[model samples]
Target: MRSNGGPVIRADIYVRISQDLTGEEQGVARQEESCRQLAADLGMEVRHVWTDNDLSATKKNVVRPDFEAMLASKPEAIICWHTDRLIRVTKDLEKVIELGVNVHAVMAGHLDLSTPAGRAVARTVTAWATYEGEQKAERQKLANQQAAQQGRPYTAGIRPFGYGDDHMTLIADEAAAIVEGAQMILAGESLTAVARKWDEAKLQSPRSKVTGAKGWTLRGVKKVLTSPRYAGMSTYYGEVIGEAQWPPILDPEVHYSVLAILNSPERFSGGKRTGRTPGTLLAGIGGCGYDGCTDTVNGRGYRGVPVYGCKDTHTRTPRSIADDRASKATLARLMFPDFLGQILETQNAQEGQSGAQLQSQAKELRERLDGLAMAYAEGAISLSQMTAGSQAIQKKLETIESELVSTAGIPPLDPVKGVAGLIEGWPTLPLPTRRAWVDFCCIVTLNPAKGRHLTSMSVDDHITIEWRDVSD
Candidate 1:
């Protein structure tokens, strides 16, 4: 196609549309069709078509893939559905000028790039587009704030575990499961156990619009159990700001009690198991099993005899006997003659089940928190909403990640593999490794025999070893 010129004018067509506030595309294809008709009427050859879907020109870092490619191709001219479709930024407009490309819009008409008057017109039109974009953004921000204050669903993202598709209404069964899980956690069940129960019951995990993960996770369970939203409260950045419109799954007192248990110092404090010297095997994993403490047991040499004791108290037990007791109990229950085979089988059976699921969910939740922060910064979410929401998510993420890191040191145990081959290489392993294995292998509860003094208690009955049973 040619005009009154010696050569044909070839123009690339560009189109873009951000997500509609009302959830429609608003005829972007029709705009493209109109642009093509304009190009034909002007006798300009259509060189290429560029498009960016669900992308906002107002966003500073949004990549318009085709737009960049068109500029690189250096077409004679560019045609777009509208002026804003081409650009709402002066930097992009300057790029078009440097490339010496004229631009036209179906709605705004011809842009002559060769002269100063035309350049002025292009800049003016782009500036208006930029301003309009900014105004719309501000309006959206205000709307988000209003939605948050009114306890309405605001973000068009993943539905939380107990919430329905609308995000405002609760799903009855899931909501009941959340409350039951929280009660279990508060009742002294491990997060992993609760998660296993959920998986066993075939409960659905929280669905992500982004990550698309649908596996039950210890991390996900904790998030549901600890979230203030489950208690019918709205949070901004971990701080509860107001009551939500949704019904509460758990009583406020029950929620706070669960929070207390989840946030306990013992749950997070890197115990003696964390920074032990190479030979200090049980230092961090030994908990003070007395009336006041369930923290990790501590190991020490008392009167030249290896002993395990509560670091914070006078409670103590002979370390050699405690280790032997724990080892035998674990072997009897979790890993017998075929220690390596049993543990490996247990681990293989749990692949993509608990540990992996929990880790992935923790990571996904952390990303969700980061997204909330970004939305807040961009003024798309209110300050209170971001703060409360981020705080809740961050707290849960931290707990999950901390648990993940803490568990990283403990390998699946294989008693038959010997001291140097078993998990944490037996007593010669790193402090953290030894601690983690001790925690994983057994629950040691120590107390003075009924009538004996603390120093005179018999090793047999003074301590109780409950070997961990990993069935799921």
Candidate 2:
């Protein structure tokens, strides 16, 4: 095959494409074919072919395994479809030049690495390629920002869980699951439990379809629950921008409540009782009523009998009796028309500082945060000042979000005649749901008996139930 050389030069073909949208590697395939033809025309024997499909060469941190291997092989020459495909930055160009081998680009002609003029040309071409990549990145960033501000659905990433491929049309089954999962989380079900339930139901996450992951992870389930997209909102850089064009899987109030609960500092900071599925009905909801004691009462065996006892051993009550009383009290409150009316009235009156207002305040605070960051970037403020200012704004945002969770109120009950069906089915309800109902209606506390041994004391004398006010 050699026309002018005594020994044919060995050449390796390298191909790369930034994005393979179809995941078909067609671009890299085409480039490899062109490179092979170029090698034939140059009278070089193609020894190896290296491809980095769907990988960007402009990013400094991205590692191209095949490219590295081609360089290490020390081929007499390298062939590529284009200079941009082979290298997009000066740093990569320098690495190629260090090999002291000729480069033959089908589109850009030959580059003799052994000559100073050829090295300069390679550097110049790489610099231009880097400039083009940066300009393209800036244009894409602007387009995404505009799309978010206009409340358009992002079509780039994998399809969201509750939506169809378009990310706008809702899939009824998936949407219903999302709603149910949100309610379960709000009713004190653990994230792990919800994830297990979904996995058991054969629900697949977005990644499962691509990676063949068999089941959902706790983190995946949490992301679905807290995503603003499910609430029909568009987000840019983690800040909600506007209402999305897609229909919402969850009501905004419920979405905000889930966000607040999951993001609560107390949930992460020593609040062990929150967001856990209780082993017993009154395990975490009941507290000790002894003077100067503020500890939760847990369900455990006392003398082989199930009882709710203080963590510090200050007081204990029969679990059966306490649970019965609390359930009865909650059902009674729900059954009373006047009590239900009072709750509705109180909720209505609090619309002045409702979820919408809190969202607005949150948006304002987020803007202030952006401004603070910009100021720091421009050297208008010191790091300490920026930190202090951001901290204060963040605290206010947390308080508003916490208030949003409280205003979400009790989960809706089944619409049955006279509300009797709910009371009848109360015994068959899940423990977490029942516990949430109890928490909504009253606070149960166990106190030491006035003058009797703890074991001999009647539950009625030792347990105190304080009904929550309608406003609370």
Candidate 3:
């Protein structure tokens, strides 16, 4: 608006809304409309409109692009729905004050940044807003902790894969897919294979459904298999707190088995080999049997057939023959009453705690750690006290995890299925389990067959099976 009949003041409207869950920008639209009306009431000429939709002003490290643009424009006047919408902290207040513009707010009235008293008033208002924001954040954090302790499902963010929008109700089709995926992983199917099957079946991921994207990644499939929520567990900050209110999509036994396989150091190597799924039985397990060569073999094509060859070309054998030899040797060992009895004895001895008991212990340890952290946060305990308590709990957790790894790697065999049943079901066992059985029972090595063609090599003449000491 004109001052003393002078040229009309050029004004810019800045509007922002911290959250717009519907993505409709309705909140910002209302802010802009009120700001425009404020500008008109002051008889100012509107030159530009700046909007930062669904963007927090008080959150740390948040950037408001349109707010930055409005400041750069340096309009003669600025109008907003409220001072809090324009500036939530003293630092931001200083920025607006330095712009040297006539600031007007529909709710907060005029702010004269040009005067020292006006600048002080702006800083005071922003300080209160900052305090309110921090208090709100603390309340929300406490609410989340209480919800986790009560076994309430987290209802924010994207809906989980096997659950409905509320996160408590199960989605039948998605739940079935999750159950099948967990079974497949335990049966030796690779994460990539399961993801491909899901994509082929047109089973969309939660993220895919929201974004209209259509496929699942290997990582996504692994996430579903590893999530404790499917086992009816509630977690806070990645630590299991209690049983969830929702029905489980998978049995706890199945869930823990999948977790054990996915988190195995031998399989993942600190996640360095996450995407590499061995297609052959002994590609990585079997070593080169030739003297002076200690390299592992890898699967490759040889004369239009798959073969496992040493990296140093020390020895090569048909993949089929090597796999068959390893399978037969492993099966034969499992059929031996004394050998099978020894394996069962060792497994039973090592399994100190049942899966359910271990799970309960782990949950208790996690809760203890969480309690320590909260105590430290609330100043109820000294930092040293919290650290010592946390470290002690962590050590116990490590011991439990080590035991879990040992027990999880045990062969997934049914005790009801005797030795004869194992032999009958040997061919149908998942490749992963078969490979694990081979590694557990014996070491298969492809020795060089002197003067013999690759096709002419026999398991008896070239393959060596060295049985491991089960008692050890």
TM-score of each: 0.49, 0.58, 0.58
lDDT of 2 by residue, 87-153 (tens): 8888888999999889999998989999999898888888888999999999988999999989887
List candidate 3 stretches off by more than 4 Å. 1-3, 208-214, 269-472
Point out the worst 10-residue segment of candidate 2 by lDDT.
265-274
Q: What is candidate 2's local distance difference test score?
A: 0.79
lDDT of candidate 3? 0.79
Candidate 3 structure quality by residue, lDDT tens digits, 42-112:
88888999999978898889999999988887888888999889999888888888887778999989999
Write one digit per residue (lDDT tens) for candidate 1, span 1-472: 2546568888888888876333344556777798899889888888887877677777877888877888899888888888877778999889888876678888888888778998998889889888887898889878766666677655565577778768878788888888788888878998877888887777766553334566666667777887778888875434345678877789976876677576543453323423424244445655556665666556667678776666564566777677777656644543355544565465545442445776678769967988998999999999999989988887776555544433333342332354346533454544444445556667767653445654666666656877655542
lDDT of each: 0.68, 0.79, 0.79
In model 1, how large is the Cα lDDT of residue 239? 39
| Candidate order, lDDT descending | 2, 3, 1
Better of 1 and 2 by TM-score: 2
Q: Check candidate 3 and list the clashing pairs.
A: 1-43, 1-44
- State, as a TM-score between 0 and 1, how close model 2 is to the true structure: 0.58
Q: Candidate 3: deviation at residue 143, Å?
A: 1.1
Clashes of 2: 0
